[model samples]
Each structure stands twice: as structure tokens, then as C-alpha cells.
Target: MKIAIISPGPFSVPPVKGSSVEHDIDEVTKMIDPEHQVTIYTRTCATYPKSAVEENRQFIRFPYNGPKPYLRRIISHIRKRKPDVIMVENRPIYVLTLKRHFPKIPVFVNMHSHVYGSPGMISKDKMKKVVRRASGFFTNSEFLRRHFMKTCKIPAHKIHAVHLGVDVSPYQVAKIHYSIRKIRKEIGLKPEDRVLFYAGRLMRAKGVHVLLKAFKEVCEQDPLARLVIVGGTGYGSNRLNPYVRELKQLAKPLGDKVKFVNFVPSAQMPLYYQVGDIVATPSVWKEAFCRVNLEAMASGKPVITTPRGGIGEVVTHQGSGFLIPPKDWKAELPALWKLLWSAPSIRTEMGKNALMRAKQFSWYATAQGYLEVFETALKKRKAASPPTKQDLRKTG
Candidate 1:
């Protein structure tokens, strides 16, 4: 059961900031059998030592001097410490390297999201080749599985749709230390104020701007409504990013009705969700799974999100929460205004529904699903190609 998770050369495992892919890798690795050896390959610019082991898992971080240097370092490490299976995060180009060098080793290319931005470095044809060669593909949502099948022409059997799960303990209703009264008082929210929370990167694609625009209209009509944004620039970068600047401009006219809190640590995120009456993830782009929705649902708050990609799979329309059409903030406005202005009993009922729905997803369940995929891929690889003299020598 030895596993090697190859992370993209941008972030570390158990990402200190916002990295859904790295966070999933960290969680799944922890859920795997402690008897099995699991190692993660990360990229870092820090001056710390190159390798470290913690929590029954090993991490080998390589310096990101340049593409060539990083690739050389990664190749060197993989050659020396080959694992029973290779599980790679997104960025198919890197997996192509493993396929080229260790063709027999079963490789699983897990797709977290396809809409992170441009894939400027890797050509389309080369990426398709990587998809075709992978022993199996893991997608976080059924929407993404279909996308891969359509775009890559990968066989349906090769793709597995396993939804991501949230760490629900911190968000449990009884386990939470911060009560609604304390959270509201700390945030300067009045007893009568209604809060709409958004906790994610301030990037435009995340639909922060859409939320701001809709909130402005909602606030104009309902002065008691407030929007609380809790996240800074993504990818652990502290610099004042352009998206942050743009979001500020969009929120300027709205004044203090819109509050922006810089990146809150993962441990304290539950407080923000507990304080708010509603969680709004107005993302314009098609999210693969929309972890924010699940986190909010776990925190016992209904979400008003778009029915893009796998988001519909998580949030039921008017059941646990309301699902709006993508990029249709105008449509979102009426629903948000109605919900924010609704009676306390109505909101509470929806929150109860959200909590019930959130209970169905768990990190342990997600880990088991991934292990099943790994076992199946290994079985398929063994049947397709028995060990040859070269593979046997390499194993020896």
C-alpha cells in the first residue's frame, strides 16, 4: 500500500492557505492505513531542509529554482524512492514524465479542477496523451468526469467520479466553541443585522465581484443586511493582489455594509460561518465540487450558490439551499434579498436541512472511495501487462 502523491510545484500539503487539491491530498493520505507508507512531493522556496516526516507520512520538498531544476530534482527523488503506485494532483504534464520513465507503474491522475486558468506551458495534445496513458482518472465531481470524457475522449470506465468531503468536526454544531452571539459581537454585528458570508479567494472567477454587486442591491433595499468576506489573495501569497484591489473597488460604494477580513486560518473558519445567516458562493466559473458549499452546510447555514458543475450535486435547490443560475447575479439578487429579509424561523429551518445534508459527506468516506479506485487501477494494470524482465529487474 505504498503511495507517492506528486503535488504540483506551487504549494505544500495541508496547505497553510487555500489549496483544495493539496488539502484533499493531505486529508486522504491521513485517512489511509497508517501501516502503509505515504509520501508527498512538494515544491518550496523556503530555506528549511529538503525532507521531513510527520504524522506517519513523509514529505520531500524540492526547491523551485526553475522548470528544468525542479524537474531534475523530482525525477531524481522518484527514481530513488519509487512507490507501489503514483497518485498525482492536477497538471498532466508532470504525470507524463512518470508514464515515460516508469510505464508499468500504475498512475492515477486526480483532477481537482479544470478551470484554474490557462495551461500555457503544456500543449493540448500532450495533455490529452497524458490523460489517455493514465491507468485511471479521479474527478472530484460527476460534472468533471463527463468533462474529461468529452474533452479527452477517455473511456467512461477509466474515469471515476468521487466527490470531495469536508472536515466536519470543526464545523459540528456542538463542538464549535464560538457561539453566534460572541461571533456577532466580535464582528460588530448588531442583534438585528443579517449577515451573508463568503469565504474564499478574492479572485474574480470565484465570483466575489458578483457577490459584491448583488449585495449592493440587497443592502440598498434592506439596510440591515451585511456581507462579510473572509479570505485574502489565494496561493499563500501575502502581496496585495490585483483581484483584491478590484474587489475593493467594487465594494467601495457599498461602504461598511460590506466587511472584508483577511485570510482567516482553517481552524477559525467555522466562526465566520456560524456568525452568518447565509453563505453565498456566487462563483461565475464552473466549480468542480465547491467545497465552500459543503463547509457552510456543515456549519448549519444554508447557501445561495450557482448550479454550475458539481455544485448542484451538493446543494439542493430550495431544499438545503437555493441554487441560482451561473453568472446571473441579477437572478441571485431577488433570492438573496428574499432570504435575508425572511423570518428567522424560515432561515433556521433551511439551516437545519443544510446540516442534515452535510452529514452525508466525510473525509473518511472519501478516503475509502479513493482506495477502492487505487485497488481497481492496480488490478487493471496487472491484468493488462504482466511484469516483464525489465520491470522485474527494476523491482529488484
Candidate 2:
């Protein structure tokens, strides 16, 4: 089968630094059956060629000045390819555009976040049109699938929940080559320090400020407690913004107890994960699906995160990590941090459980899920359509 995947034009197909959607596309395409011809349509990057093939997936890049021209070029190429199925990544508007051009072809919209489907970005009427026209919808989690059903008035049958996966091999290899003591010493942390790590955009929505507030109380209680915040204001962007300034201000009283590591390359994230005793992703917003939770689990570190949106679907509270309510994070986080800090055995056990859980979610499984959805949508479309003249002739 020939599959044409339309990537959200903001980033390149194989992400240089960060872009979870792009990274996901790259991983899933690589894991997909080699027999199936998969083509990814993405924005041109200075580092990569205009056209390249890797792991049986072909990438076609186009210059992206704005959404209008970028999507127009993609649509023109997609028409030429005449793929069996078209998958639009995180763009509901693109689904409508594709359906207008190839009304009979099965077009599936993969919703990685609620941003595109929200009333703020696309109106209720247009969202409904997308639901009506598109073959099916693939959400990263059941929480997001239900969200679209509630907000866009999409039918339950039209949406499918497919969870994302993590590549645990790198984390596994990192464990063998790198020691916790060495990583801590390299990062200016003492062997005795109890580290609480946070990785993601250092924005208000990510709850970095909340983590800082909680860490302040933790520091007051436990002298050995340390906080390590990793990431920039945005993906591949380290420019300090007002929110980052606010976060720095919040961390001022803590002094050297807090360490802010600017955006690290995606390849080096495993080493940073090893630097912490416990990973904290205190997200206030309803994350569609927090990849941090899976990455931390893969690194064999316990997590303390909010059960917002699809995050609850990923992290099993008390089993792999603690799922503190966002509202009660101030009280709960410090207490949980202290509990995990004091008990090394408990932390080790939970880390083991986390690794086992992480192993279950692989890129191969994720790619298979996508393939199943594509096949289902195609079969449904074929069954609904009238028999072709060739088919009628064959029957006659």
C-alpha cells in the first residue's frame, strides 16, 4: 500500500532538536512495514536534503514561508502521488482541503493535540465539516478522542484512540555506559543530592513555576533536595521570554539548589534523565499525550505528574509514578518528593516497574496501530462505495 503522510509544515520530517510530532512521524514511518511505500511531506530544513529515503520511508521537503503556500505545494504533490491513503498530521483544516481535492480517497486526520480542533483555532462549523468529510480521526489518547467528540460533535465511530510509544533502547544503552554517580558529578551535583528533574518547554502551562514553588518547600524540608529544569522557552529556541524570567525569579531564593539547563539535543536527553532520582512533569494544561512520562519511564526513573488529559492513560499512579492533582501539587509534590527521596528501595522498585511498563510501548507497536487504522478506514470506504465498472464486469 502507498501511504502519503502530510506533516505539520512547521518542522522538518526528521527533527533536528525537538518537535514531538515530527519525531513521532519519523519513528512510526521507520517502523512501518518496508513493503508499504510511505512518503512524508514536510518543511525543508537547511541540514537535510529536499528529497531523501531512510528506513523504507521517502521524504519530500518544500519551502515553508507560510501555511497557504506550504499546504498548496503539498496538495499539488499529493495529487500527483495518488496514494491509497492520506494521513494529515495534527491539521484539521488540511483534512478538509485534502477531501475537497480527493473526495473519494480515504483521508485520516491524526490529532496529536487539541490546539487544531479547539474552537479558538477552527470554528465549530468547520470542525464539524472536517469530521463529516474525513474518513476517520486518530487521537494520541482516549482522553483526546473524547475531547473531540465533545467539542466538535464528532461521532464515536469516527475517532480511534492510538497511544504513542517510546524507544527504550537508547535509555537501556545509556544505563550500561553511564553511571548515575558520574552523571551527577558532571552536572555539579553531589552523589548524596536528591534530584527532581523536569524536562519540557519552560512555559507557564508546563507548570515549571508550580514545580519551582513546590521545590522551594521541598528544599526547606530536605537540605539535600535539588531541582534540575531542562528545556528552553520553545523547541530549539533558548530565547528568554517574560515567562522564563518569571521562572528564574521564582528560583532566585533557592540559589544553587536549582539548575536550569538550556535545551539539550534530543539525542542527549537520556543522560539528563539519568541525572535525576525522580522526574517531574507538572503540566497544568490538559496535555494530549505527554511524551515526557514515557521517556522518563523508559529511563527507569519514577515520575510525579498531573493526570491531565491522556497523561493519566500513560502513567499508572502509585504503580510507576505519582499522579498528583494539579490543584493540590503545592502540598502533594513536596510530600511525594520527600517520600521518594528518603526511600531508595521504594524508588528503585518503582523505577523497575516504570521500565517494565515502558518496554510495552514501542514504536513498532505504535506503527502497527496506525496501519490497522489506515486499513480499517480503507475497507470501510471501499464497502460504502458503488462497484466500479471493472468490478461489475468481473462479476458478470
Candidate 3:
């Protein structure tokens, strides 16, 4: 199969933190490289160093990612390549443009998340329209698959699930130099402090506010408890993100119990994970899929997340981690505090179990899943094509 994938932002391709969507494209493209030809159309302000570009795959950057202006360029490129399959990372603004631009090819829209929760750039109604048109579709989790079906009225038959994978090997329980004490002193840990970490976006949907509230309660229960919140500024988000200010005020009465890091590079993430006694992902709204949960589990740290969207599929409460009801952090507090006070031996056992669970989902397996979809698309496309003019005369 000859495949073309369209992405909206800079090409932060494989072995890097290229956002979740890019990770999906890179893994799938790598998976099918031996059997098929793949091309990824990315939007980058700067070009990739030639030494880093892949030999088998092609990456093309464009001027504008939006449709009204970029559609002609995309059409021209598609005409030149004439790919057998089109796998687009869909956006509502580009649906009609795609309908006219790549009219005949088999287009599969990989809907990683809906625009329903996004503050701007695209509306929910617009996303629904684009999702409804794509003949083939894929989602990050079963929870998200259900959301797509419910919101867009897309039939379940057209969609399939291909969960994202993380590099689990980098994180281990071997007690490396970046141990909890090593990270604690760097972050200014107190003598009796207990660290409960929350990593990822500080967005409303991420439920960080709820985690802070819960941390306050935990602090009241045990004075030594400290919570660290880590994430980056929103991508193209206009909302006032002085969360560090708000969160500090909220945690103020509780004393020195909260700290925030706006950005943490991928290389140093495992060390931070090594410092966490228990990881929390307290999202009020349903998560499309929580990659951080898997990352925590793989790093041999127990996770506590709500059972919404595809997160429940990974963070099995009490088995691998805890699941508290949505927006009910108080109820979730006791279980979390218990883990905080538990023996190091008990926590280590849970961490081992967590790592064992995370090993099941890997990039290697994720790649294979895409191959199944690509191969199926190729077979179906071949079967559906009508005979050529020369064959029509033979049939007559």
C-alpha cells in the first residue's frame, strides 16, 4: 500500500515527543515501511536536517496548514504521488476541502480527539461533519470510539481502535542515580516529605485543579505531603493559564505542599517519575486516552485516574492503580493517602505490578495494528475497483 498521512503541526517525528498524533503516524509508517511506501505531509516552520530524514518515507512541509489556502497545494501533491490510500489526521476545517481535493482515494480519518473541548480554532459541529464523511476511521481508545459514534453518528463498523504505545524500557525499578532523594533535593524536598506527582497538561479538562484540591486535603491529613504539577503551556490556547498563581494560592493555606513545573523534557521525565510515590491523573472530563497513565505504569509507578474514556481500559483501579469518581476528589483522598503512608516494600510491589501491566502495550504492537488496517485497506480497495476499458471489451 502507498499511503499518505496529513498532519497539522511541526513534524516532531519518532523517538521524540512529537505530540500524540505525530507519534501515531511515525509508528504506523515505520511498521509498514518494508511492505509499502508511506509519505507524511507535515507543517513545519523549519526544515528537517537531511541526515535525520528517513530513506523510505518522505516528509513535506507546507506554508499554511488550513484548507482554504493550502488545499490547492495538497491537491497538486496528491496528484503527483497518486497514493493508493490516504490516512488523514482529521480536522473539522479541512473536511470539505479534502472532499474536493482527494475525491477518489480511500480516505481514513484518524480521529485522536474531538474539538468539543478545544477553546478555539475548530467547533464541535464542524468536527462532526468531517468525521461523518470519512469512509474509514480509527480512534485512540474504545472510550474515544464511543464518543466519535455518539457525537458524529458514525457507525461502529467504520472505526477501529489502535491504542498508543510508549517506550517502557527506559523506566525501570532498578533504583538508578535519579532516585527519589536525588530528585527530591533538586526540587527542595523537606526531611519528611512525601511526593505525589501529576504530569501533563494544566488544562481544565485535565482535572489538575481537582488534584490540587485533593492534595490540600491530603496535606491537612499529613503535613509532610507535597504535590508537584508538571506540564507545558497550551498549544494555541488563548485562555489565561496563570494556573501556577491560582494553584499556589489554593495550596498556600496548606503550607509548602505544592510545586509546579511548566515544562519537562522527554529525557528527564523518567527521573521525575522515579521521584513520584504515586501518580495521579484526575481528569473531570473523559480523557480520549491517557498516555501519561501508561507512562507512569511503565515507569513502575502506580496510577490513580478516573475511569472515563479509554483511561479505565489501562488504569485498572486497585489492580494497577486507583479510580476515583469524577469531580469527587474528597472520596478519592483516603485511598491515595493510604498509599502515601504505606511501607516502601508494599509500594514497590505495586510499582512492579504496574510495570508488568504496562509492558503489554508497546510501540512494536501498535505498529502491527496499523499494518493490519493498511493491508485490509489495500485488499478492499483492490476488490472494489471495476475492470478497465480493455477488460470491459473482453467481458463483452
Q: Which candidate gets the maximum lDDT versus the true structure?
A: 2
The models' CA-based lDDT, in order, is 0.79, 0.89, 0.72
Put the candidates in lDDT order, highest first. Answer: 2, 1, 3
lDDT of 3 by residue, 1-396 (tens): 777777754444442442666766776676555667777776545435422347668776566655555556666788999987777774545555777776667777777776532437567676566666665677878888877677667788878888877767677643475365766787777757777999886677888778877777777677678887767655222244586457667777765577766566556677778777789898887778888899899888878788877788887777778788766786668556765476676677778888888988877677677667767877886688887899889999
Worst 10 residues of 2 by lDDT: 176-185
Give the number of colliding residue pairs in candidate 2: 0
The C-alpha stretches of model 3 lying farther than 4 A from their native spots are 10-18, 50-52, 65-67, 116-132, 173-183, 190-192, 235-244, 389-396
Q: Whose TM-score is higher: candidate 1's or candidate 2's?
A: 2
Model 3 poorest 10 in a row by lDDT? 44-53
Model 1 per-residue lDDT tens digits across residues 1-396: 778888876666667665778778887777877777888888774533568787768988887666567767877877888777888788667777778888878888888877421257567788777767888888889999898888777799988998888777778753356476786676778888888989987787788888888788787678888888888777555457777888889899988888887787665677678778789998888888989999999988889999888899999888888888755776567666675466777788888999899988877788788888888777876778878999989999
- The sequence of per-residue lDDT tens digits that candidate 2 reaches over residues 255-314 is 999998899878788878888889999999999999999999999999899988889898
Instruction: Quote each prediction's TM-score.
Output: 0.89, 0.96, 0.86
TM-score of candidate 2 versus the correct structure, residues matched by position: 0.96
In candidate 3, the residue pairs with backbone N, CA or C atoms under 3 Å apart (3 or more residues apart, or in different chains) clash, namely none
Candidate 2 lDDT score relative to the true structure? 0.89
